[model samples]
Target: MFTRIGRFVVRRPWLVVVAWLIAAVALTALSPKLESTTDQTEFLPSHYESVQVSDLEKRAFPGQEDQPAAIAVFQRADGGAFTDADKADIQKVATGLQAKHYAHLTKIQADPAAVSPDGKIGLAQIYADNKDLSDTTVTENVKQLRVDVKELLSGTSLKIGTTGPAASALDAQESGDNTDAMIMMATLLLIVVLLGIIFRSPLIALMPVVLITLVYLTANGLIATAAKVFGLDADPSSSTMLIVVLFGVGTDYLLFLLFRYREFLRAGMEPRPAMAEAVARVGETIASAAGAVVVAFLALTLSTMGMLRSMGPSLAISVAVSAIAGVTLVPAVFALLGRGAFWPSKAWKREPKNALAQRIGAMTARRPGLVAIVSGGLLVALALGALGFKADFDMGGSQPKNLESVQAMDDLQKGFSAGKAQPTQVFLENTGGGKLAQDQLAAFRDKIAGVAGVAQVSPAQPSADGTVAQYSVSLAYNPMEDKALDLVDGALRDQAHAAAPDGTRALVGGTTAVLADIRTAVERDYSVVFPVAGLAIMIILGLLLRSVVAPWFLMISVGLGFAGTLGATVWLFQGVKGANGVLFSLPVLVYLFVVAIGTDYNILMVARLREEIRDGNDPREAIKHAVARSAPTMGAAAVILAGTFGVLMLADNSMLQQMGFAVAFGILLTAFVMALFLVPATTTLLGRRAWWPGLKEQAPNPAGEEPVLVGSGRTSG
Candidate 1:
């Protein structure tokens, strides 16, 4: 199948190249912009308490629902306590801003009663005309409100800055946009520099950059089109992640073909046939590696979390597109470039000495059991840190501390209750669908207020129908902290549910409740999604290797790498750095990338090992040569891919920094430890049994794939 594809592409390279160009351009022009939401409730299932509260509020209250779109925090110019006159200035500013009746500005609430105890901070809550923060009108209103507030405060003794849902959303979106640009530029530079260092040819370095850029455009357009057609909403971080996946994975596939293509060239074959033959030989390997990634990602569709469910299919689409291009478009481009792909460097004509790889090969060959034990043991020791891993669900903490919202919120906390910014709300719906008296509302509020973590509970405001009541319950701690998680998920929920009046059932819903639910959902995903992904990946490895035992051990190695990576991160963040916790989703991301995407390195290495064994070398000899040959490819690819993600560490956001470190460190472990050391050593120890039922070690070598000489650049043939 691959041979036919190679020949066809080689015969009409121009046709292949032009088709890809058209696809990228046409899709880019026609597709609507891909959009995402940051609203936590939007991602929850209807059954979750938070989602239910939202639904009930929207349905029962209709036009009455109004939350702050932005909070205008006012203070004296020198940061002194606000005098009575200054409070009047704050009220005047709010009243004047309200009179302008800006678009999407619902109402500006400012009160002397809302002043902080320290008297240094004053607050004004700006309601929006819309609900969804994704709506640009909300963001625009935030911008306009800031301008209006500035104008209203002109020449006054006080200064005001806006912070809240709309303003924070605007700032976060801008940060993401800038970070995405930085990630792209950094990834491109990283790939080019690494590829140049590895191949010693500027063309080889620049070729994958240009080719993958085109493929990225095509895939991105397809993802947007598919998402729009299907009505799917993806996670906000999907675009930045897709950038790394396409370039890192795409370049790895290209390198696989380039290495083999150059081998055939050194063996004295014509450039076109050599390119075709190279495609024929390694195409299955590339397909299987990509297939593993695609399946693991697709497994995310099983996730109950909407973020994972939507993100899964989008990433899978990207991987599928990259794999297709790897087999077709990449070969065609090289077919045109031919021997000149490595121009200005005659290294392609002879074997280059890779001393480090050779030494690793010799060490594994001399002591397979030792290498396997030591490498496996190191990973296991590192994996112990997983026991201390803590999950943080705070969106505010993940932002740069310097962000206006974060800074303003911190200032507010100094003079008010930490959780005052967004308090937990509990709703009581009359199950009998009857009116609720003031007594029942008071009794329910008292019950919630009795909870240990409950600092304050506002009076219950009954709906017009009188069948529901809303109470704002502020906690003694920050809404995003672990104390908040336990309090909301445990004590508050328990109290509310247990103490409801006979005709009323209570539902706890707020930022903290939503956070606790997200934690529960992710925990459930661990049991469901992780197992499903593992099983799916094992099936792919089993089918690709035609070996039952190999898949099990290979998966074991990858799993260890996942744990090791997490443990290392936990040690760094939680232990040494004294962080409250790593980002909540770090484990999920690590498992998906390290256990799934990292499998690519293992697949490449093991396939090479199997090839050496099929070429009639002893298992130990095969392990030696395979490590020597595959190490350079996997190492180069790993460094480049890891660097691409590591670029995220440069981001100001802690979420991006944690994600970047996890993936980058995991990739290094996957390549250097599992693929380079453990897998080959263990395979040598297992010998022919690794192939088991297929047991093709002594089988005849296929005609097109002659046993290439391992020691030298040229083939034995």
Candidate 2:
């Protein structure tokens, strides 16, 4: 099937190229603008407690202001306590900000009591017009608010800084935009330089950059169109992920084909026929590898979190698009370039000795049992570190500490309770639609204040119709801390539910509560998505290899690589670096990249092993030759892919750093240990049984000539 495709593409390279161009243009012109949100609450299902609280708030507190409010903190520039004059100047700035009628500004609130006990700081609240904390309008308002605050504070001793959800969103977006540029620039440079070195041809180095760019535009357009048509809430980070996956995996598939083409050329085949043959040989492996990634990504749809559900399909689409381009567009472009694809270099005409690969291969063939034991032991040792893994739900904690919002948060903690800046709220709705007495509200508030973690509770504020009452509860600890999440998720929630009046329903809502529910959802996803993805990948492997037993062991090896990668990350971030924990999403992110992308190396190695065996080489000789041949391609591809992810370590975000290290390290392990040493050695040990239920005898040679096995010029079978 792939042979036919290669033939057709090579015959009409211009036509294939033109078709891709037209499709790219049309898709870009027609697709809707891709949109993303930073609102975590939107990602949760309506059935979750956090979402339920949100719904109740809207219905019962219809007139209540839902917009996120920023706090403007003022302090004397000389580090002394604010005097009466400084305090008066701070109030003047707050009044001036309110009068400016900024685009999203709703109101401003200031009070003398808001000053700290040390008299070093004063606070003013700037409310936004929108409910979305990360909305562009709110972000814009924050930008203008900062500028206006600075202008108003001119010539005064008091200086102002803002913090809160709106300010944080603005700062985060700016930081992310800069980070995205860096990531892209680094990825492209790595691909170009690495490819140039590998092929010794500038043209070949730039080919993937040019072609994958087109694929990225097309994939993004298609994703946007799908999101629009299906009303999916695609995460903002999906675009960044798409860029890496397309370039990394797309380049990988191209390398697989190109290496095979070069091999055939060295065997004295013509360029066109060699290209066709290369496709025919490597197409199934590429398809199977992509199938594993697509299935793994699609499995995210089963996730209870809307972000994962949407991201799964979006990433699946990207991998599918990249796979298609790898088989079609890439081959067509190279067909036109022909021998010139490696112009200015004659390396493609000769095969290098690759001494390291040769040595590893020879060792594996000679001492399969020892090689297997060593490789397996290393993975087992690394896997032990995963037992200490911890999850951090504080998204802001991953942001750079130097960010204005982070600085503001620190400042706020000094003047108030750690949780006072973003207090948790408990909502009580009268089930019977009756107004509650003040005495009943007081009793409920007393019950909540009595909870061990509760620092203070504000008097109940009733809705206009008196059907619901809300109380702001501040915790003794920082709201994003594990202690706070535990308190809200466990005792506080339970106590609130139990202490509600006879006809009232109690629901807790806030940042901490939302994170607590998200933790639950993520835990649920681990159970469901992992098994489904594992089963799906195994099916692809089984079908590709035409053997059930091979897929089982292959999956086990990949699984070990995944656990080792995660364990290594845990050791580095939590155990060694003394981080509170890695990002809550680390496990899922690691699974997606390591398990799915790592399988590509396994498929390439195993496929070559089968081919070597079919050529009449004995099990041990086949292991040596297959490893010698496939190792260079796998190693080069792994390095490039791993390096691209490693660029994330340059990011200020700790989450990105963790992800970068984990995925990159996993790729190296998969290529070096599992795919290279362990898999081939185990296959040699298993012998013909590894290909059970499939042909064990040597395949017939089309030339009707005896097979000349590598390393030994002996004819076999």
Candidate 3:
């Protein structure tokens, strides 16, 4: 299959190149603009309580203000309590803000009751016409609101800061934009520098950047088109992730092909025939590795959250497109360039000794048992750290501490209940289709307020028709905190549901409620997605290796690598740094990259070992030669892939930092420990049994005779 593809591509390289160019241009021109939502509620299924509450609120309170609201908190410049004059000035400022008529801002409401008990802070509610907290219009209005408030208080002795869903969303959006730019520039620089160092050729370094850019554009367009067709909501982080995966994995595939092409050149094969042979030999490995990644990513479709479901397909599409390019566009370009692809670098004509890889292969081949034991023990030691792992669902906690929204939140906590900025709401609706009596509202509010962790409960506000009543309940803990999520998910919800008026149904809704539901959904995904992904990847490995036995140990090694990566992350963040918890999504992200991409190294090494075996080398000799040959490519690819993710450490977001470290470290482990030593050692120990039912009937001729390549009729000596 790969030989035919190589021959076809080599025969009409221009045709293949032109076809890709046209597809890229056409797909990009016609695809919809990919959009993302940061609204957690939107990702949840309607069956969840928070989502149900939201639906009920929309129906029961048709005239209710669904807009996102922020509180502009004002304090004295001198740290003094608010006096009558200061209070008057605050009201005046509020009135001024209302007069400014900011776009997307619906209203500004000021109240004497909003003053803190210490009399040092006053608050005014600013409402936006947009209900979507992540809406760009809401962010724009909040930005303008801050500027207008600053101007309104310019001459006064008061300072103001905003905190709430809208303000936080705006700050996060701005921070994300800055972070995205940094990540892209850093990733590109890293790829160029690293590739230059590895190959010592400007053309080789630049080729991947240029080719991957084309792949990135095309992949994103196709993903956007698919999302538009299927109504998938792409996550805001998808674009950033796409850049990393396309460059990291795309470069890995290119390196696989280029390194083999160089080897064939050293073997005295002509440039064109060498590239063709390289494609024939390495194409199946690239396709198989990419298939594993695509299948693993597609497993996210089974996720309960719409965000994961959308992300699954988006990333899968990216890897699929990248795979196609690796076999088609990439090969075609290199075929056209011929030996000039190496440019001034004459190193391709002579094979280097690669002393380090040779030494590793010699050691592992001689002492397979000791090698396996040491590597296995190291992974076991690291895995223990995962025992302490905890998940933090607080998205706000990931933001930089210096941001205005974060500062405002700190100030708000000083004067008000921690949950004051975003209170939980419990809506009680009349299920009997009649007006609910006002008398029953008090009992419901009292019950919710009486729950542990409850700070205060606002008086119930009934809709005009009296069919529904809404109560704003504040918790003593921050809405994003685990205690708050627990109260909302368990006690508060239980008590509210049980204490509702006889004819009404009570539902809880708020950020905390949404997070609680998200936690449930994520926990469910762990059970479903991981097993499905694992099984799918194992099948791919089995088919690729032509042995069920090799796939089992291969998957186990990858699983160990995954555990070790998670444990290392927990040690760095939770134990050493004393963080409360890692990001809630860290496990899934770790599994996706560490297990899926990490498997690439495993597959590459094992495939090379099989090739050596087919060359009539004994198990020990095969392990040594395969490691000596494949390790350089594995090391280079792993470092580049790991470095790409390591750039994420430069991000201010904790989620990005954790993900960066976890995947980067995992790749290094997969390359240096599992693929380089443990896998080869284990295979040597297993010998013919490793191939089991699918063992080759006869080894290829040891003489320099052309041997058939997998999935291809063509042969290469």
Best by lDDT: 3
> Scored by Cα lDDT, where does model 1 land?
0.86
State the lDDT of candidate 2 residue by residue for 1-717, as single tens digits: 776777787788899899999888999999999888877778999988888988888897675554647888777888789888888887788789889887777887778788887888788887876778788878888898888787787889987788888888888889888888899999999999999999999999998999999998899889999999999997877766777788889889989988988887777666777777788788899999999999999999999877788899999998999989988899899988989989899877776998999999999999999999999999999999999999998888889999988987888778777787788989988999999888899999999999998988999989898989999999988899899999999999999999997988899989999999989999999999998999999999888888989999998988999999999999999999999998888888889889999999999998888888878788899888899899989999999999888988998988888888998999999999999999998998899789877745554534743322223232111
Q: Residues 1-717, candidate 3, lDDT per residue (tens digit)?
A: 787788789889999999999999999999999888887788988899999988887787675554647888889999899989889899999899889887777788779889999988788988876678668887787888788777788778899888888888888888989998999899989999988987789988888999999999899899999988988987887877888999999999999988888887777667777777788889999999999999999999999877788889999999999999998899899989988887788877777898999999999999999999999889889999999999998889899999888988888889998998899999989899798776688878888889999999999888878888889999999999999999999999999999987878899999999999999999999999999999999999989988989999998998899999999999999988888999888899899899999999999999888877876788899888899989889999999999999999999998889989999999999999999988998998999789877768444434754442333332221
Ranking by lDDT: 3, 2, 1
Per residue, candidate 1 scores C-alpha lDDT tens digits across 1-717 of 787888888899999999999999998899889988877788878889988998988876778647657778888999898887898898899899889887777889897788887889899988876878557878877777777777788878998777777888888888889999999999999999989988889998899999998988999899999889999887888989999899988988988888888777787777888878778778988999999899889988887788888899889998889899998999999889877878788877877787899999999988989999999999999999999999988877888888877888887787778888788989999989899888888888888899997888999878889899889988989998999989998989999999997877899988898988988988888898888889989998999888999999999999999999999999998898788999887888899999888999999998888778777888888877888888878888889889989999988888899999999999999999999999988888888889887757445435776432233453521
* lDDT winner between candidates 1 and 3: 3
| Model 2: per-residue Cα lDDT at residue 403 | 90
Pairs that clash in candidate 2:
none
- Inter-residue clash pairs, candidate 3: 1-711
Candidate 3 segments whose C-alpha is farther than 4 A from its true place: 697-717
Error of 2 at 281 (Å): 0.5
lDDT of 2 at 506: 95
